[model samples]
Target: MITLDARKEKVGDLLRVSFQTQIKFFLSNTKTKAAKSVIYNYIDIFTKDVEIINLMKEYEAQTNKKLAITLPSEEVPSRDAWVNSSIIFDSRT
Candidate 1:
Protein backbone atom coordinates (compact mmCIF):
# COMPACT_ATOMS: atom_id res chain seq x y z
CA MET A 1 0.00 0.00 0.00
CA ILE A 2 1.26 3.45 -0.91
CA THR A 3 1.54 5.73 2.09
CA LEU A 4 0.98 9.47 1.94
CA ASP A 5 2.93 11.88 4.12
CA ALA A 6 0.86 12.99 7.09
CA ARG A 7 3.14 16.02 7.64
CA LYS A 8 1.93 17.46 4.35
CA GLU A 9 -1.56 17.89 5.72
CA LYS A 10 -1.90 21.66 6.08
CA VAL A 11 -5.57 22.18 6.86
CA GLY A 12 -5.13 24.61 9.76
CA ASP A 13 -6.24 27.59 7.72
CA LEU A 14 -9.35 25.78 6.50
CA LEU A 15 -10.32 24.66 9.98
CA ARG A 16 -9.73 28.10 11.45
CA VAL A 17 -11.86 29.75 8.80
CA SER A 18 -14.66 27.22 9.24
CA PHE A 19 -14.59 27.58 13.02
CA GLN A 20 -14.64 31.41 12.89
CA THR A 21 -17.45 31.47 10.35
CA GLN A 22 -19.63 29.00 12.25
CA ILE A 23 -19.21 30.81 15.54
CA LYS A 24 -19.97 34.16 13.95
CA PHE A 25 -23.10 32.73 12.41
CA PHE A 26 -24.30 31.42 15.77
CA LEU A 27 -23.66 34.75 17.50
CA SER A 28 -25.32 36.86 14.81
CA ASN A 29 -28.39 34.66 14.82
CA THR A 30 -28.93 35.21 18.54
CA LYS A 31 -31.65 37.75 17.74
CA THR A 32 -33.65 35.00 16.09
CA LYS A 33 -32.73 31.33 16.60
CA ALA A 34 -29.26 30.21 17.56
CA ALA A 35 -30.10 26.67 18.63
CA LYS A 36 -30.34 25.65 15.00
CA SER A 37 -26.86 26.93 14.29
CA VAL A 38 -23.97 24.49 14.34
CA ILE A 39 -21.42 24.64 17.13
CA TYR A 40 -18.21 23.05 15.89
CA ASN A 41 -16.54 20.69 18.31
CA TYR A 42 -13.51 18.41 18.66
CA ILE A 43 -11.47 20.70 16.42
CA ASP A 44 -7.71 20.27 16.75
CA ILE A 45 -5.78 23.48 16.10
CA PHE A 46 -1.98 23.57 16.10
CA THR A 47 -0.10 26.82 16.60
CA LYS A 48 2.93 28.34 18.36
CA ASP A 49 2.10 31.90 19.41
CA VAL A 50 0.59 32.19 22.87
CA GLU A 51 -1.68 35.02 21.73
CA ILE A 52 -3.38 32.82 19.19
CA ILE A 53 -3.81 30.17 21.85
CA ASN A 54 -5.59 32.63 24.11
CA LEU A 55 -7.74 33.84 21.27
CA MET A 56 -8.78 30.28 20.53
CA LYS A 57 -9.84 29.96 24.16
CA GLU A 58 -12.21 32.89 23.73
CA TYR A 59 -13.60 31.27 20.62
CA GLU A 60 -14.06 28.03 22.50
CA ALA A 61 -15.94 29.75 25.30
CA GLN A 62 -18.28 31.26 22.78
CA THR A 63 -18.86 28.05 20.88
CA ASN A 64 -18.54 25.72 23.89
CA LYS A 65 -16.71 23.15 21.80
CA LYS A 66 -14.23 20.46 22.74
CA LEU A 67 -11.71 22.24 20.56
CA ALA A 68 -8.01 21.54 21.06
CA ILE A 69 -5.37 24.03 19.96
CA THR A 70 -1.89 22.62 20.40
CA LEU A 71 1.36 24.56 20.32
CA PRO A 72 4.06 22.45 18.79
CA SER A 73 7.59 23.22 19.97
CA GLU A 74 8.81 23.80 16.43
CA GLU A 75 5.82 25.92 15.39
CA VAL A 76 6.35 29.56 14.48
CA PRO A 77 4.17 32.66 14.39
CA SER A 78 2.01 33.18 11.32
CA ARG A 79 3.33 35.50 8.64
CA ASP A 80 0.30 37.79 8.63
CA ALA A 81 0.08 38.22 12.35
CA TRP A 82 -1.97 41.42 12.14
CA VAL A 83 -4.99 39.89 10.43
CA ASN A 84 -4.72 36.28 11.63
CA SER A 85 -4.55 37.50 15.20
CA SER A 86 -8.08 38.76 15.20
CA ILE A 87 -10.95 36.39 15.90
CA ILE A 88 -13.54 38.68 14.36
CA PHE A 89 -13.95 37.72 10.72
CA ASP A 90 -16.48 38.71 8.10
CA SER A 91 -18.51 35.76 6.90
CA ARG A 92 -19.11 37.43 3.54
CA THR A 93 -15.49 37.11 2.59
Candidate 2:
Protein backbone atom coordinates (compact mmCIF):
# COMPACT_ATOMS: atom_id res chain seq x y z
CA MET A 1 0.00 0.00 0.00
CA ILE A 2 1.40 3.33 -1.11
CA THR A 3 0.18 6.51 0.47
CA LEU A 4 1.48 9.51 -1.43
CA ASP A 5 1.27 12.81 0.34
CA ALA A 6 0.33 15.75 -1.82
CA ARG A 7 3.51 17.31 -3.22
CA LYS A 8 4.44 20.22 -5.47
CA GLU A 9 3.49 19.59 -9.09
CA LYS A 10 7.00 19.13 -10.43
CA VAL A 11 8.11 17.27 -7.35
CA GLY A 12 5.14 14.97 -7.61
CA ASP A 13 6.10 14.09 -11.18
CA LEU A 14 9.61 13.20 -10.12
CA LEU A 15 8.27 11.13 -7.24
CA ARG A 16 6.12 9.14 -9.65
CA VAL A 17 9.19 8.28 -11.71
CA SER A 18 11.09 7.31 -8.60
CA PHE A 19 8.19 5.14 -7.49
CA GLN A 20 8.53 3.20 -10.72
CA THR A 21 12.16 2.52 -9.91
CA GLN A 22 11.16 1.37 -6.45
CA ILE A 23 8.69 -1.06 -7.97
CA LYS A 24 11.51 -2.54 -10.00
CA PHE A 25 13.57 -2.97 -6.87
CA PHE A 26 10.67 -4.75 -5.17
CA LEU A 27 10.34 -7.16 -8.08
CA SER A 28 13.99 -8.12 -7.95
CA ASN A 29 15.25 -10.71 -5.45
CA THR A 30 18.08 -8.53 -4.20
CA LYS A 31 18.86 -8.38 -0.48
CA THR A 32 20.91 -6.77 2.25
CA LYS A 33 23.70 -4.43 0.99
CA ALA A 34 22.31 -3.73 -2.48
CA ALA A 35 18.77 -3.29 -1.20
CA LYS A 36 19.92 -1.00 1.55
CA SER A 37 21.92 1.08 -0.91
CA VAL A 38 18.92 1.54 -3.17
CA ILE A 39 16.74 2.51 -0.22
CA TYR A 40 19.31 5.13 0.85
CA ASN A 41 19.50 6.50 -2.66
CA TYR A 42 15.72 6.81 -2.74
CA ILE A 43 15.75 8.68 0.54
CA ASP A 44 18.40 11.05 -0.81
CA ILE A 45 16.30 11.75 -3.88
CA PHE A 46 13.15 12.34 -1.82
CA THR A 47 14.93 14.72 0.52
CA LYS A 48 16.28 16.69 -2.42
CA ASP A 49 12.88 16.73 -4.03
CA VAL A 50 11.34 18.42 -0.99
CA GLU A 51 14.24 20.87 -0.88
CA ILE A 52 13.65 21.87 -4.49
CA ILE A 53 9.98 22.47 -3.80
CA ASN A 54 10.77 24.63 -0.78
CA LEU A 55 13.33 26.68 -2.74
CA MET A 56 10.83 27.25 -5.52
CA LYS A 57 8.21 28.40 -3.04
CA GLU A 58 10.68 30.83 -1.48
CA TYR A 59 11.68 32.23 -4.88
CA GLU A 60 8.05 32.69 -5.87
CA ALA A 61 7.25 34.49 -2.66
CA GLN A 62 10.28 36.80 -2.98
CA THR A 63 9.68 37.59 -6.65
CA ASN A 64 5.90 37.91 -6.35
CA LYS A 65 5.48 35.45 -9.21
CA LYS A 66 3.24 32.40 -9.49
CA LEU A 67 5.18 29.15 -9.83
CA ALA A 68 1.98 27.04 -10.03
CA ILE A 69 3.03 24.32 -7.64
CA THR A 70 0.79 22.31 -5.38
CA LEU A 71 2.43 22.58 -1.99
CA PRO A 72 2.16 19.82 0.61
CA SER A 73 -0.41 20.04 3.37
CA GLU A 74 0.54 21.72 6.62
CA GLU A 75 -0.30 18.68 8.75
CA VAL A 76 1.11 15.88 6.64
CA PRO A 77 0.14 12.52 8.09
CA SER A 78 3.12 10.39 9.10
CA ARG A 79 1.66 7.35 7.36
CA ASP A 80 1.81 9.05 3.99
CA ALA A 81 5.38 10.25 4.32
CA TRP A 82 6.89 7.37 2.32
CA VAL A 83 5.96 4.36 0.22
CA ASN A 84 6.71 1.80 2.91
CA SER A 85 5.78 3.99 5.84
CA SER A 86 3.38 1.52 7.43
CA ILE A 87 4.20 -1.68 5.59
CA ILE A 88 5.76 -4.73 7.19
CA PHE A 89 7.96 -6.81 4.89
CA ASP A 90 9.07 -10.17 6.24
CA SER A 91 11.35 -12.58 4.35
CA ARG A 92 10.87 -15.44 6.77
CA THR A 93 7.40 -16.30 5.60
Q: What is candidate 2's lDDT per residue for 1-74, written digit by digit as tens? A: 53334444455466646653553454354333343344444443343355444443444444465544343557
Candidate 2, residue 33: how far the Cα is off, in Å: 2.0
The per-prediction tally of clashing pairs is 0, 0
- Candidate 1 regions with alpha-carbon error over 4 angstroms: 1-9, 31-93
- Which of the numbered candidates is closest to the native, going by highest lDDT? 2
- Which 10 consecutive positions of candidate 2 have the poorest summed lDDT? 79-88
- Evaluate all candidate structures by whole-model CA lDDT and list the values in order: 0.42, 0.44
Writing each residue's lDDT as its tens digit, candidate 1 over 1-93 gives: 533234223445555556556656555555212322222231223333443445446556656764543445585655333233333334467
